[model samples]
Target chain A: MRNLLILIAKYGSTLLFLFLELVCFFLIINFNKSQGEIFLHSANLLSGKVNQQTQKISDFLRLEAENDSLLTENARLLETIINFRIHDQENNFEAFENKDSLAIYKFIPARICNKTTHLRNNYITLCSGKNDSIIEGMGVISNTGIVGIVNNVTDNYAQAITILHSQSRISAALKSSQYHGTLIWEGSEANKLSLITLPKYAEISVGDTIVTSGYSTVFPAGVPVGKVLNYSIDGGGDNYKVEVELFNNLNKLSYVYVINFPEKEEKEQVEISDGN
Target chain B: MGTKWIGLIIRLLIVVFLQVVICKRINLDYGILSFAHIFIYPVWIMIAPTKIPRPLLITIAFFIGLFVDMFYDSPGVHAAASVFSAYARSMILRFLEPDIGYDTDHPFNLNKVGILWFISYCGVFLLAHLFFYYSVEAFSFVFFYEIIMSTIISLLFSVFIMLIFILLSNPKY
Candidate 1:
């Protein structure tokens, strides 16, 4: 009895160490993904608040760049408006109400509360949520290019799954050829993405522009995704993994627009009707 | 004794603040890898008075790592590594046991122990901790290269700042 007690006393610390390590490993192996997500979302509440405060301070230092982006956005908006006005003047004002009813896209402007581009499953939190009509699964984009898709929403905060995240796949195509493929981030460089699922015979070359295919309604067609850097054939030569350099400087982005498709539900409903 | 607790608390706060607020933001990315996070949290466990009981020391070490894990958004990784280092600490002390044994409570003090001894001791412990950390994060033997690369880079980066921090503090036991 005494020997057993002595043994327990002598090695108790080692036993405790092993026990705690076991618990931690269990958490790592079992809780690494889903459970960690819940904890992270809750932690986001605190981190989001901290990021907002620091973002304000950093925002002050970045006023010049912000002005430049805003100016550029304004000019682009003006050019499109001028193009529309010219077309309307040549045609008629009789169909103006019909054109208004056909308008499908709305943009919700929001500042990024917190964003991380360096992690495997990166997420960006926008400062607007349900209150601003920003719902789950809406696409987000910067003035420069596509940013991400909104995945979760709180009352006043929405978590976006950034393009830099692992498991992030978006439909994209060649701007010139319309050869559609999947754009994926390989958990590495924030500026680079891999466009895969391209057929073996697809004519592709460096610097070729890529854009959203609009196969689904997530993004409008011809929204510039990236420019091809290079490509290589797979071992079987059935497909190619083309490297693309994204236009959005993800690390420096502050303002983004969450996209709403007013006709998405109607489109889905129509697509689901019984075959004719 | 009260002063000792207060000093420990202050150092704890300093380490946590530097890690979460400052070091987390300093990403020296050359390419895909950004490897410039300086980990000063090991000093929290290292600075405990040598007279503290082994079980309690390990418990404290686990919690310290758990605290760091919370900030890093990587649960289990830091805590596992910290406990491993804590469990190995007594053996390390015994291996380097002096002719008269570790007599002073202030074993981490650089003034008491010479610079060489302090550096080598911290170096070994931090290496073990970093190796355990990167391995856990890599999560598989398939990423052996990544584990080794991160371990070596983080160890060198952290040890430099840790030595500087220790010199500046010049703690009294």
Candidate 2:
């Protein structure tokens, strides 16, 4: 009894240090996707309002550039309108309507509040939540390409685990061959992530476009992920680990969109059953 | 002694305020040296009364760090740094046992310990503190060169400023 007591006393601080370290590790390991949902969502709403207010100021300051973009878009649209009238009764009209719907799905705007890119596990907050009809597992995007997925939601705010996070895994495919694989963050750089598990038989090339596979219901089909930067065959030459340079610069992220799939729950259920 | 405590509290409040409000605004992002933030809160850890109980000292250190973390938007870096400093302090005190005494009844003084002993005391622990703090932040040795460079620069700057505070104070003890 005395020896046991002495031993415990002897190693108390060491034990404490180990315990604290374990606590920190546990916090790191179990940094849940759900706990941050409320704070991030609220922050998103507040930041969204703030961003909207500041945008007016920025718009006023950059009126010339804004006008230039508007003018260019106006010119393009005017040309399209003229072309449309010229081809009013033509075959391309059907094609144009289809393209319009595709372009319409390109944006699902949200406001950012609490965002961090430097950490191993990075996350972003947005101002669209459950009440906004935002749901967990919705695809998030920007003007460029896929940014993240809606991980959780509160009444008025939503949080996204960005592609930069080590915990993030997305289904991706080669734009050319439609070969699908897993995409993961390398944790070395903010801008780069990796697409893994491509079969050696699949033809891949440098600068080949990578996009969301639409394999998972989170992101819709054919959203641009990045261009293939580098790749190498595994030791057995069975698969390729390819580097993907993300289109949405994780560092310069500001506004994003939460893509709401109306049939998400049903789709996920189907996927789960199929997996089983 | 009462006046000293009041002065210390006032200085601590100012340090915390400036660290959050002003130092954060100074955005100096050189490769490894954000010179502005290098020693912002370490000053508090350096000046805390040595006589305070170890666990309480560590708790205060942890909260002070957490407070800095809240403002800086970093979750745990400062808290971890401060706690480690508190943990290692007694060992540092053991190593740098002053020949006479630390004037416990009065207040801490640099002159009493002399410049060399003071420097030795701060130098050893400050380096250890910085090493652990930076390692936790970097989280890996891949940025080994960068971490070392930052550590050296930050430690030097922090120690310099710490000495300045100590010398300027000219404590009666």
Candidate 3:
């Protein structure tokens, strides 16, 4: 018993060290599964914030290059969308192209340099001009819907009259019944335009989609105009004045495409002497 | 005797602070070595009075390493490393002892030993400590290459830092 006591006294601290290490191993193995995750997350949060602060320096240096890449990516996506539309039309027998007819519409991509939606005669200036084959009477549209018709052109830039202009008129129709009408904007509202000349017999309802009629050589047919919000009939009760919510918001304009209908000029030249 | 313990406690606090606060945040990753961790806390156990009981020294080493593990967010690894180091310390001390041997209450310190002898003593212990630390941290033999590289690189840095601390403070424990 005395020898055992002496040994206990001699090796007590070593036992304690072994015991504490066992506890540490227990904590490391067990808590590491659950609490350790939270602990590491909090620690990483501290270090992550420090990294973010330092990363800001490198991020600022790469900002211009990043912006250039993002813009190029956006352009590529837009081009892909245009190609998909062309492919879709090729497969669609009803909307199939006729090479002998007028001319195929080619989209010329352009960025909006300036726009004014508050004015009675709102105009949108595009980056593309006469140099890019953009001419007066060419129609402009965005990813959303029809935007405006080309009104003037310079060597480097072109100005188009927006759909919100009071004088600007577009031929559109009810998608379901094919009842055609003229889309005109009142001077008061920017986004809300009225579809006039829609026959009363036409199947018109709230939320009915209005699309360009393809009757005019400017705007293509089936370009989404907007949904029907409300409509009224005149005293004659023959035509509908449809309050339409436009898809293209001029205030949010960025990139736009000018659609060139090649047959327009030749057909118009054969009829009238207007070179547009 | 009590003053010796007081000095030890003070050194413990300073070493722990240096380990947890300052050394923890150093962005030391370079080359194939993942971390250049400089552990100065093991020096607290290394330079204790040669006459102290081996078990007591080992226990203290365990606690010091456990304390560091709490802050490092990796429990058990430092404790395992420190305890191993402390156990190995007794053998190394016995091997490196002078013919005259050590006197009770007279601890090894920079003032007591020649600089070259002290540096070699610190280098051997720190290398072992760092090797065990990285080995336990990796927790797998798959990181054999990593463990060796980290241990070698960290040993160089840790020993240099330990030497600098000894040279500057030159603590008498």
Candidate 4:
């Protein structure tokens, strides 16, 4: 027993290293499999707080740029409102009948407290959550284009799976031909996305605009998504895979709009009945 | 003795602050340079007093790495690399032993060890740290090419930064 103690005393460092490394590998594997939820959550919360403090200083410095962008967005929203008013006047007889369509999507503005763009699966944290009427599965968009969908929420903060995430599959269509496709990230460049399942015969070209299809209750119809960068025939040779360049830079996002679709529950209930 | 411990703690705080708050934010992703990440945190373990017990040194390295990983949003990749390099440090010091030998209480400061020896020592450990870091980060041999490329590129930048830091501080302890 004394000899064993001597041996341990001599090789204590090596033994400790082996043990520590074993623990580290355990963490790596478990975290990769997403089974380290408690660790990840607490880590995120702590880091989120540090990032929030840093973000405040940078946010103060970028106030002028933020104001300029907000002004342009305000002007664009005002123009849309004006157009709606004109359409309502033109269809005055039908306007009263379809009033629900006029206010289908309500936008809840939130600031991005923290985000990451380089990871295979990226997530964004917003400064608003359940207390602010934000909920899981609500679609998020910046002033420019689609940001992500809300995945988790606390009392005051929420997490979103950005479009850059591998599992993010947004329904999109060509603005010109209206050919439907699934938008997905290929885990390479930050700004590029792939639109798959587009029919081979669809009229597609470089610079063709892509927009939300409104098939899902998340995003409204005709929201700007991206522009086609290139296209190729899928391995199956039955569909066209078009590379899309997003309008939103994503890396520089500061503020976003969480889409609130009030009729989502009603639509989902109807779909469930149909399935039954 | 108490002062020495206090000095070490202060240096630890400074190094951690520099790595987590400053170096973490510096994106060197200009065209074709995306793979080069700056990591000087390993210098903390490298510059520690030579007489520190191996078990204690390894433990310090592990916790510091885990602290950095929290900010990077990666759980264990950094800790694994740091531990590996910390384990390898003693072997490296033995290999690079000078004719006069080491003063166990003092750190291998640039002035004490001379430029050539200090550079080689830092370079070798930085390379080991970064290689292990990228390998564990990829977590698969399928990305062998990516792992190699990132290690070499990051090594160059990290070594350069280490040289500048050593030259500036030239700490005796």
Candidate 5:
């Protein structure tokens, strides 16, 4: 007992070192609480500012595509107004009838400020946030298709877990057959994601469209994910490893939309009750 | 030894700043060489006070590493590697002792301890430091051979940088 005590007293410094290291390890593991949130929030803000500056510099180059989308929107609006007017004219003869087919959804534009595709858990930052009602878990979509899911929100900015993240498991389905599979990133490729657990019998082919399964409230039904690039079989079953060519060229993504589900709170209550 | 402490602090601050503000933004993908990281921060362990309390030294090393980790968005890697080096610093010093004993508690300088001793000391420390760092960063031995190769290359680069810093400071050997 005396020898043990003497030994402890002699090597106390090493013991202290071990203790400090363990404490540091614990802190690092549980660093996700509030400090991480603050870092991500600030990073999002800074990245957003940089992206905005870059976008302004590059806006002149994308004018043609922006003009094309605007023209298409304008044509659709004109056609809707004309059709509504004609229907109202016809309905006037049938006494009282409501004839308004106004579009409900409006795109709240925000720029992609910061994004990463190489990390295990990738995330993106947008220029818009709570000031624009860009709450957590909102769907961020580009003009081409789905971009990511919002995971953090501050007063002036929001951060998103992009489709390229290894941890991003999005519910997606084949456009033709509607066979649902979980879309996952394989941690190495930026231009591809693995669509796993697909049954072999499903008549899948290259160039087939992939879209959101709408299993979650975050994204609406039928938001495009990517086109199927390839498939293969594994020992367990026919695991189709899809090379998803993302719609939003993540490298070039500048603008996106933050979507809000009006019935989100009600849905959450229902989900909680269901769980219980 | 006093100047060494000042130099370590200054270099650490510069590395953290450069890594966070500069290197974090400069990722060039070269296939197998995926990312070329320049780690000049371990100069702290390379020049720390030889006789400081081991626990306090480890704690100081941990915080310095943790600060770097915080800025770079990678958790635990720098901290783990730095603590390992801090723990091994005294051992390396003990091993590199020549026929004449190091009388002072200060670090063995190039002039006092000879160039070969300093080189071997720096090499061993760099090897241990890089071994822990890359192993932790990779998190798997599947790329066992790759890890070994990367570790050697990284150590060589780190040693080159350390030599540059030591030369620039022109510390009284």
Candidate 6:
């Protein structure tokens, strides 16, 4: 105890200096707005760099699995192209009937740099941004299901608001019944979403598949979303509220595709004029 | 000894007033570029009597910086920088110790120390204080370019003003 006291006496000033500096930093971050944001942003950027390095090693190990998924996706794309060509020949006989249905969507591949699934409003950061032609409001999807919508973009990074967010509402429909509804998150489960506005009369079962309705210019039609888990009628009794189990495991996502629609501006303009 | 303490307190009050009231208003702007800020408040910490206990000196430095921060609308940035410089003061003193060594009885002043030693001593502490102040204000090393630019420009102006103040006052604590 005597030696301990001597050490304290010798180093008390240094200890006090460090403690007070810590207090100052705490106060600085808590009290100031811009400083706090800068601190958090820098911290995120630093962590992103570290995550990128680790992801590279893990990605190398999972190359075979990743190649298999890519091969499957390529085969699906080839089938889609062949089907489109067949439809084009049929369209020649029925020209101008399906001109608007031919909305072209380009897919840009990106790797997830950072993501959060547990937050009330979770966000995913992509490694590709303006350089890769990504912009705000673009739909992001995995091979399994829908992922998110691009919220903001920087030079080399883009932030996306996932379907797990409270404010996220995507236009979805039942594959069998063809009834449309709004997919929303209830801020609890990460993998479950609520599909509202579906009419009670629509034939819905537990195993019915849900897919994007393509009402908006963000996503193309018939993209896989989830499967209906269960459903209930609200107090109004006019609509069915469905609980959907997402196809993609958001927690294990690594790669995603951002859909770039060329006709988005034209569609938006037409809608704005129709609104007037 | 008691009179010396009173004199020191009075000097501190005057320095704080000059910093908050006068120096704060002097904007160094050239068209669109406003590069420099006059930070004469650190002069008090730079010239404080070496005989004072280190912990007490650092604590006093914190409150003085907090007081200045109140006027600047920054909560703890100045206080942090002040504490850092005050804590670093002893090491600087030890590094610059002459063959005869420092007379801890008197505060550092142009009248007590020669021009070369005084300038070097104040210059080192002022650099530490300003760099730390800017770093805490920015709160990120990502704006390292802006931090370095502001530090160099502000350091030049602050040192010039400090030399003029010391020459005129010729203070001896």
For model 4, state the Cα shift of residue A23 in Å: 0.5
Candidate 1, A57: how far from true, in Å? 68
User: With candidate 1 superimposed using the best TM-score fit, by how many Å does residue B133's alpha carbon deviate from the native?
Assistant: 0.5
lDDT tens string, model 5, A1-276? Answer: 999889778886677667766765565545634434544666688999999989987887887678657744643443343234434544443222222333222345677778886677778898788998778877777767777899999998899998887677788888789888888888766767778877677789999988877667776557787898887874676666666777667777776766666666787789989994
lDDT (0 to 1) per candidate: 0.80, 0.71, 0.79, 0.85, 0.71, 0.85
lDDT of 4 by residue, A144-245 (tens): 889999999999999999999999999999988888999999998999999999999999889999998878878777778999999999999999999999
| Model 2 chain A: worst 10 consecutive residues (lDDT sum) | A27-36
Q: What local lDDT score does residue B119 receive in model 4, on the 0 to 100 scale?
A: 83
Q: Higher-TM-score candidate among 4 and 6?
A: 6
Candidate 6 residue pairs in clash (backbone atoms < 3 Å): none
DockQ values, each candidate? 0.27, 0.04, 0.20, 0.26, 0.14, 0.52
3 versus 5: better DockQ goes to = 3
**Candidate 3, position A172, lDDT:** 95
Predicted structure 4, TM vs. truth: 0.45
Which residue runs of candidate 2 sit more than 4 Å off their true CA positions? A1-107, B1-173
Sorted into a CAPRI-style docking class, model 1 comes out as acceptable
Clashing pairs in 2: A41-A157, A108-A257
Per-candidate count of clashing residue pairs (backbone under 3 Å)? 0, 2, 0, 0, 0, 0
How does model 6 score by TM-score?
0.51
Candidates sorted on DockQ, descending: 6, 1, 4, 3, 5, 2
Better of 1 and 3 by DockQ: 1
Candidate that scores best on DockQ:
6
- TM-score of each prediction: 0.45, 0.41, 0.50, 0.45, 0.41, 0.51
Model 2 per-residue lDDT tens digits across residues A224-266: 8899999999677789999888888877866676665555678
A5 Cα displacement, candidate 2 (Å): 99
Best by TM-score: 6
Candidate 6 stretches with Cα past 4 Å from truth are: A48-276, B31-33, B107-109
